[model samples]
Target: MILSGTYGELRSNHFHSGLDIKTQQREGLPVYASADGHVSRINVQHYGYGKALYLLHPNGYTTVYAHLQNFAGEIQKHVKETQYKQETFEIELFPEAALLPVKKGELIGYSGNTGSSGGPHLHFEIRDSSQRPMNPMLFGMDVPDKKTPIVSSVFAYPLGADAHINQSQKLTKLRLIKQMDGTYKTEDVISYGKIGIGVSAYDQLDGAYNKNGVYSINTALNNTPKFEVKFDKFSFSETRYLNRYTDYGYYKTNRSKIQKLFRESNNPLSIITNEDDNGFIHVQDSLDYSYTISVKDYKGNDQTVIIPIKGTKSEILNPRAIEETEDFIYSDHATSLTKGKFSVYIPANSIYEDIYLNIKADGDTLIFHEDVVPIHKNITISADISNYLEEDKDKLFLGRLNYKGKPYYTKTSRKGNKLIAYVRLFGDYAVVSDTVEPVIKPMNFSEGKWISSQKELKIKITDELSGISSYRATINGKFILMEYNYKNDVLTYDFGDAINTETENNLKLIVIDNVGNSATFEAKFFRK
Candidate 1:
């Protein structure tokens, strides 16, 4: 099977925990159990791994199948009963071992595009008893990958304030030349002091054109191992450390991830092993060094790059640029800022290093630096709304500025006269008022229409402002389970549920926005 995303691939905010298997660009593909196991947990939600199932195998491994369309056989029946009993579509259930045991290769579910999925695919993973995800390729789930990894770009960074590369204290992009025998080489580099390297590369398996993540990356200085990182396994708790491991500053400007060959002081990713000086090369005067980088795929196909370095200690032509302001945040200490009606609280260790920030407040807007730096933890921002009337307080929320300079609704909480929001990125924020309610329209069967041959009923629900918060539907005063697909803004109810018994039925739906504005839709239809 071809893979759209590989295990341990670089993603926004975290590393991909599983392999995304391509489903031929469509849905409804039969998914079978990987091994003899019992259903341990079942979760149905609108976000994340929607409609996911966890199976505990006899070998102390748990296999996860996510983004499913529906469960098969008894599993489907059990889930439906639990939903009806709980009166909620989003529910988590754990079945006992004797209740839902299955043999290997048994049909478990059908694959579909659900929960935060970009398209139709299956997100499959294998985790140990401790819940750490391991590469499925190590467990004999093989994809045909004979092609070597392609190194698209290479860069050298002046690690310290005194270090310089190519006579500049900024990161320099090296020109790579393809040599014979399927290898690469870079021009001679001149520098002195500690410096690091980074590379952007991808792997392409046979029969698939998608560029997937490489399996391993290694670097050596003077024939000694400097840094080694393998995508074998990693824990979920340490996944967000990906930002600190890679060149996050470059990613924000270039829109590409460059895997750094060195480790930062606060980066504690278990997948990496650093040698002397944490993978930083200490170039000294009157010395010559040979640096090598090797990129490999899971199938042993590899590509190598060699660079010749000359140690020449010279005067600093271009020094590091520093932006300092009156406000400074120590990485190890908590700091709070208050200006007018806005306030911000940053916890200790929220940043990897101590840095200066340009923070200010203008009326109702708060400018909290830019998005160049990566934050390790969340910081809280609160805006006082005591000046607003009591009637408008419940309809107000905080919005963060997007890339397009437009403010979008953020999850907010209220404490008396304060509207608080916790965020990771530093950007412009302001308080916004949303009084508009959600809009609901019938999709399949309209008012006073007969839907005798329709297999399901659908309605389109949308919110133009603060977004939909909650929704509930009932048929003749009885709750009916309606699956909501937020991607398409469609709410669907299967006729198979048998909720509509009489020839004529009345349907009522109530949708509420995040600002407490509610809208209701009512319609009458003949189903029999």
Candidate 2:
């Protein structure tokens, strides 16, 4: 099997917690239990790991199979009954040990393109008893991997205010040349004071063109180990530390992850080992240093790059300047600022470091700095909405504008005359309104039609502004489960549920948007 994503790979806001195995661009592939275990838990949702199953093995490990089409045999029966019992499409259940047991290699479910999946694939993960996801490759799961990792770019950064690389205070990209022996070397770098290194690399397995994450990276200075990190396992709580592990500011602008060899003071990621001075190299006058970085895959294939550094002090050509602003946010202290009708509150430790931020209000929009800064926790942004008419208050909401200046919904709440939104991103936000109601249209059978031969019913629902928040459907005055696939904007119901008891049935569906705008549809169909 091939992989689309790797464990501990860089993802938005968090690390990829599992391996994404390619399912050949189609669904309904057979999925088997990894070991003889009981069905511990099941989760069905419109987002996240849709139709996921958890199996608890006796060896203190839990194997998770996510994005499944349907469960098999008795497991499918139990899930259907529970959904009807709860009268909801999204449900979570913890089955008893005696309820559902299966042997290893037994059929459990079929692969699917559900949840937030980009395509048809299985997101597989193995967790310890403490629920930390461990690399499945460590447990003897193997794929054909004889290829080495590719280092695309290398950069040198001045760690301190006075440090300089190549007589410049800005981060410099080093050009590399490949040798006949498959090793890389960079030209001699003239530097002074302390500096850190960053590398962009990816791995590709045998017969696969997808660029995946590497297994380990090690850096040495003057033949002494400086920093080392391996992607074996990590806790979910610490995944957001990825923003700190890499150069967050660079990623925000360049759209690439360049993992820094040096660790920040507040970075608590547990993946690094055997480090000195947090991997920062202090260059002294008249001293020469040889730095090497080794990137390797899980199958022992490695690629090394040699960087020669010479400690020579030169004239200060370009110096770094600190940008100062009236709003100075201390990382260790709670701060609140207000401008016009807009206000923002940042809690202690929400930011990685103390920095100057530009916060101001332009008309109804709040410009809360750019996204170059990484936020560890949610901060509050409030806007006074007393000026809006009472009739339009129900349609009012809070949204963040993208680069194109289009506003998208952000979860907002109304408290008195204030519209509050807790956000982790630093961007342009505005108190906007979504006055459009959701669109609900029947996909399979229309009104006053006989659909006796149809085995299922389908309907398409969509929203233009705040997006669909909740939807409910009833047949013959009784609530029936209608599974929603947000990926396709379709709601499906199986005829086998037998909720329709009479020959002539009336179906009523109500879909509500995020800002309380609702739309209703009613239809009549005859089914045997």
Candidate 3:
């Protein structure tokens, strides 16, 4: 199978967690089960792993198939029946082991660009007995490769306030030089105290040209192993640790993944093992250390980088000083700030370390610092909107203001005068109202037309301000299932299951945006 992604690849706020198999940029190719197993779990959603299936094999392993355009004949039948019974398009189902069984290489579903997929590909995964994702390449999946991993960038980081790199208290980017023997060497650095290293690199296979995740990274000093990291297996619960695993602040502005070699106090990623100094290197007063960094892919191809560090006596200069403000919020404990009609709560452990937050209130907007720092969990923002007009209260909700003065909708709950919004991203917050309704237009069938020969009904729904919250479709005053594709904002309904007759039918659709703004569509069609 052709691959587009690698397991445990560093993604935004999480690991890739699976391998993406290329489907030729199209859907509807038959997907087969990997081994003899029973249908254990199936989940269908508008985002994430859309139309995903899980199979539990007797060998204490589970396989997953995701981003399918449609399931096989039997699987599709069962899913439709369940959707109609529940009156909802997005649903999760689990059949008893005896009911749905499959042998090795049996057809299960068809590949599609469903869920949060950027293109048409199948995201396949294999888990161990504990349901933790394991590298499928380890299970004899042959991936032909001869190219070595590419080292794009390398960095030297001063770990603490006492440390200095290149005679300055800052992070320094090292220059890498490629040698004739196909190896990388970074310029020698004069550093003192505790220091860490980071690298930005990727791997590529033989046939596919896409930059995939490196399988393993090993760092050594003076012929002794210092740290080792592998992308073999990991737990889903620890996936969010990816933010701490990488240089989050650098990635926010640069959009490049820089994996830190040293583990932070809060980064509890399981992929790192066999660490000597926890991936940190200490330098003596007058000495130089030789370092080696090796990156490899599953195909046994590898690349190496030689880094030399010279110890120099230097003092930390111009360290970041915590600013004092009227509303300074510390991250160690629960911190709250209140001013005007705005209040915020930063829960304990939501932040990785002690951070000074810049908060203020101007007019009706509450500024909770810019989006520069990384937050581990969500902080609640509350505003008193009792002054708003009673008639417009339903339209008013807590919104995160963007640079263009537009509001990004969040699920806001109100109790009396307090409107609360729990957000993970740090930004300006305010009470914004959205009164414009959504727009719905038919795609496949038209008004007053015969759709007797059509297989499905499709409608496109869109909202300019607040995003779509919920949508429902009804036929003859009864609820009918309408599958929503959030990527394109299109809702589809199969005529075979819901409209299986040659008669006149009345259809009604109701679509609502985030802040109570809604629109309705009704039409009549002759189906034979």
Q: Report model 3's TM-score to 2 decimal places.
A: 0.96
Candidate 1 per-residue lDDT over residues 453-499, each given as its tens digit: 99999999999878888899999998999998999999999989997
Q: What tens digits encode model 2's per-residue C-alpha lDDT throughout 1-528?
A: 789888888888898888999988989999999899999999999899999999999998999999998888889899999988888888899999999999999999999988888899999999999999999999887889889899999999987767898889998999999989999999888899989999999999877898898889999999999999899999999999888898889988999889999898788888886699999999987899999999998898999999999998777698876789999988999998998889899999999889999889998999999999899989999999999998888788889999998888999999878999999999999988888889998998999999999999999999987888999899999888898999889999988889998999999999999999999999999999
**Global CA lDDT of candidate 3, please?**
0.87
Candidate with best TM-score: 1
Clashes in model 1: which pairs? none
Instruction: For model 2, state the Cα shift of residue 58 in Å.
Output: 1.5
Instruction: Tell me the whole-model lDDT of each prediction, alpha carbons only.
Output: 0.91, 0.91, 0.87
Q: How accurate is candidate 1 locally (lDDT)?
A: 0.91
By TM-score, how accurate is candidate 1?
0.98
In model 2, the runs with Cα more than 4 Å from the true position are none
For residues 1-528, write the lDDT of model 3, one tens digit per residue.
678999988887889988999888989999999999989998999999999999999998999999999888688889888888888888999899997898999999999988999899999999999999999998988777788999999999888667888887666899999989999899988888889999999998778889899999999999899999999999998888888888887888788889998887888889997798799999877998998999998887889999999998776564645666665555568987787899888898787877667888887898888776778888988998888888887787887888987878888988887788888888888788788999999998888999878888999999987789999898878787888998888998877675545388889999999887989999988887
